[model samples]
Target: MTFLLGAASALQLPAYQALVPEIVPRKSITDAAALSSVGVNLARAVGPALAGLVIARLGVPFVFAANALSFALFLIVLLAWRGYQRPDTRVEPFIDATRAGIRYILHAGVVRRVLVQLACVMVPANALWALLPLIAAGPLRLSSSGYGLLLAAVGLGSVGGAFLMPAIRTRLGIGGTVAVASVIFGATSIALVLVPSLPVALAVLIVGGVAWIGVVTTLNGTVQSFLPAWVRSRGLAVYQLVLFGSTAVGSALAGAASSLFGVLPVMVAAGALTAVSAVLLAARPFPSLTGRDRAPMPSTDVPPVTEHDPALQGDVLVLVRWQVAAGHVRAFLTSMDALGHSRRRTGAREWTLHRDRDHPDTWAEVFRVGSWQEHIDQQTVRRTGDDAGIFSAVREHASDDPDIEYLITPDRTETPHV
Candidate 1:
């Protein structure tokens, strides 16, 4: 199953990238977002029918085999594509780095809120995905063609929702937006089960799809926006783990309920759980929230984000995908401070400032410039003069992220990182 997803990623990302020239997104990131949205839309449209056909005609083992073959093909295609690198020139203290990530998630109110919002809808969502086809084929008594049409309707609705997410998020804030989306999801889930006919059920499912994609996209943006640069990858990994981990549990429960009661019962359970999750999340706000509901605190176990040493030099490399700080304490701080000051001074592009909630002193500024070298070249830094004398004062902190390397984007799938 995992291999098939990997294979899809290899073939699909590039194939979609080819469509970039046509979409002409408002921003580069938005283009990436659009392609991702559309690509998922395409696959979601096909996945149900494909699964139904394989299970109905070919059998479950064949479905599994097909998935494996897809993964193998994706692996071959990905290997054929160039410029994927994971080797590092040096290594550093990783355990402390892992601790730093955990501490921030535990402490950062904003990150917690985002994670909570995702969880609220996601837990019940797994049930919806699991039971949708079963209900369509069972009492719904829809033929294979009808099921395929229903899947297409859901896919179309999701794509529409993705297009609307940015604007809706802008208006509601992540907190309010997610809260509202959760309501829509729960209500739609119930509606899908209650509908008297296939067409009506199809419409409700489409609405559910819209709610699902919009809430998810908005939540993802919220998570990324709130995370500190030093722990962005790790923070995201944690989010994925929780969301997907709950999904697995949801799917399993859906299967059990379907066997014991019926598909409608499983679908109803999803809706009820979704409603409950919304209420719980609104009250508790896991993963935490920022702004008025957020705070910055001091923790003693890790160094603060603002630390600096006089001896650091050019070896200070910004970590890449899953790449963590293996460098010195003082050096990392100095580099981070320099990056923050540089970004603030230039006013050339948008950059976020995040100090660790626990280690307020160990500063780690977060920003995504045009390229990785944007930090080293400090293009805007040359304009600020802050980058000028800082190195001389802080060479003692200099060290490299041995994990630094260029990477190509891949398909979205379960990334199993503990």
Candidate 2:
């Protein structure tokens, strides 16, 4: 049952998140993300209490029946809803689309950093959830209802935190918000063990809840903002993979360590590690996303070749020659590094920069796309304002406009040497 539930969530989460940007305006995405969190936490606050009452008055079977009924209603609502209007763009094959998504993340430094930050916090933060039942049973010696109340407190606190997020984000920014929230959660974890009084633990959990929502909502929103529409769902799927994978690993480690070292020591270590991670994160914050345009602008010019053209069907290799200005080789290389990533992140299957052995000032930028169609898409469909800026910066170091060439292997012929 647990495995089945996990599989269901694996499908449900990414699809739900992908719909947010489609339904809401770009500026309201952060708020919409927070409201999604608010809904989950609100359910957390109410579900268990209701479940307990139903079990007490009716039975466990009745509680399950109610859950099934909720899902039925959800299906009905989904059936009635009209979906968002997507652009009439060419859709890649499923395998190709999946590969493109993976490639984007591989080349996107900002997204990688966000994922790393999330993992660092999530791995340790999971200790609270993994060990809370143990804490309730042993340290606090609470009854079932009391434990439910503790869960309710965390849920209620998260709901409150959602309302406070815009102000918090405005004040602290993404990095500071994550750092401070990490510290708060770490402190709460430490307090949960050291101060085992039921009342005190409940209070601490409330604070932990606030910190939890803050970190999650901020990071999730950051991912959503950074990802382009073409790969948003895939990126979120990867984010969810990291989030849940880290939780599983953390919970197992916490459980094992708690058995050997005792729950108190294990909790303390997790808390301390979480706080230390916060310090490390603050020292090296994520890159800012402000003022960057991610909207796709398709190329206006039509390609001469049709789909039936053999060259259009084969791999497309693009080569750009650059004559770097005197004494600007180093600066030029630095800018090209950014440009290379942009190429791969946009659509290039491979990208490389090479210098002419004979001519120190001359350089070559080489990239390949799956097909001519994809290369055409790279020109503007996958291009963004940020990519244009990078392109402009690279050009500033060049002595003259670089030469460009496109080549495609014929269907029955070998790839031609340059």
Candidate 3:
């Protein structure tokens, strides 16, 4: 049942998060995300108390029935709303779409950076969740209701933090906010081990909640802001994957370490590492919102295709020949490195830059796509303002227009010898 519930949640989270952009203005995306989080934390705060009351009065079965009824009510609300109309576009096969999403994450530096930062913080931060009950029962000597109160404190803090988010983000920016939040949460974790007083612990958790909501909302908002529309749902799906996957792995590790050395030692060590990670990760700060442009770039023309056209069916190899200006070879190479990532992120299966063996001034930039249709998608819907900027940078280093060629395999059965 738990696994089934997790699978359902995994499916729902991406769709839910992606809808925020459609419903809210781009400038207000972060604020909207914070408000959405306010609702979630509110539930986290109130749901337990309500459930406990129901369980006492009507039994556990009634709690489950109420949960089911709430879902039914949510579905009814969803059904009543008119949905957004999206532009009509050709849909790729499911397998191909999955491949594209994976490629994007592997090659897009911005997305990769966000995911790395999330994992770094979440792996250590998960220690709090994994061992909090143990801390309450052992050192703090708290009853079950007392433990619930501690959780309620965190939830209350999250609700309060959402109200303060706008001012906090304006003052701190994403990177500074993340760093400060990490330090605060880390300090709270360490306090858990050192202080052990119920009142002090509740206060610490409330403060920690403020920090938690800030980091989560900031990183999540960054993902939403940076990803282009075509890949937004996929990007959010990957974000959800990293967030939950990190927690699962971290929780397992924390539990094992606690068993070996005890919860207090693990808590202290997790806290220290969380604080240290903030320092290391701060070196590569997230790019500001002003810099990211997710608007679609003007589409390049693709060769016309018919139902029987072989051009539409085959793997594609794109080769671009460039002659670098004498002293600009180094600069050209650097620009190509950035462009290579853009190519792979969009659709390229493999990308490489090769200089002519005898003439170092001549360079060949080559990339392969799984199919012609996929390559066309890259030229059209997949290209974004970020890609346009990278292309412009590369063009600045070139002496003249690049020589381009598109080669497709005529037959699938024939294998080429290298």
Please say which candidate is ahead in TM-score: 1 or 3. Answer: 3
Score each candidate by Cα lDDT.
Answer: 0.57, 0.85, 0.86
Candidate 3 deviant stretches above 4 angstroms: 56-62, 87-89, 300-311, 358-360, 412-418
TM-score of each predicted structure versus truth = 0.55, 0.91, 0.92
* lDDT minimum window of 10 residues, candidate 2: 299-308
Q: What digit string (tens of lDDT, one per residue) describes model 3 on residues 1-418?
A: 9999989998889978987888888888888999999999988888887888899999999999989999999899878778876633468789988888999999887789889989998999999999999999999999998898899989988988888888999998888888888899889899988998999999999999999998899889888877777788889999999999999988999999999999988999999877777885668877556867787775442233323355357888999888887899888888899999999989999999998989878899999998887776787778888887888888888887788888886876667678
Candidate 1 CA-lDDT value: 0.57
Residue lDDT tens for model 1, 40-67: 7888787866798779998999998887
| Model 3 / residue 148 / CA error / Å | 0.8
User: Which model is ahead, 1 or 2, in terms of lDDT?
Assistant: 2
Which residue segments of model 1 deviate by more than 4 Å? 1-35, 46-96, 281-418
Error of 2 at 64 (Å): 5.1
Q: Write the per-residue lDDT of candidate 2 for residues 187-234, one digit (tens) a residue.
A: 899999999898898789888998999989998988887888878888
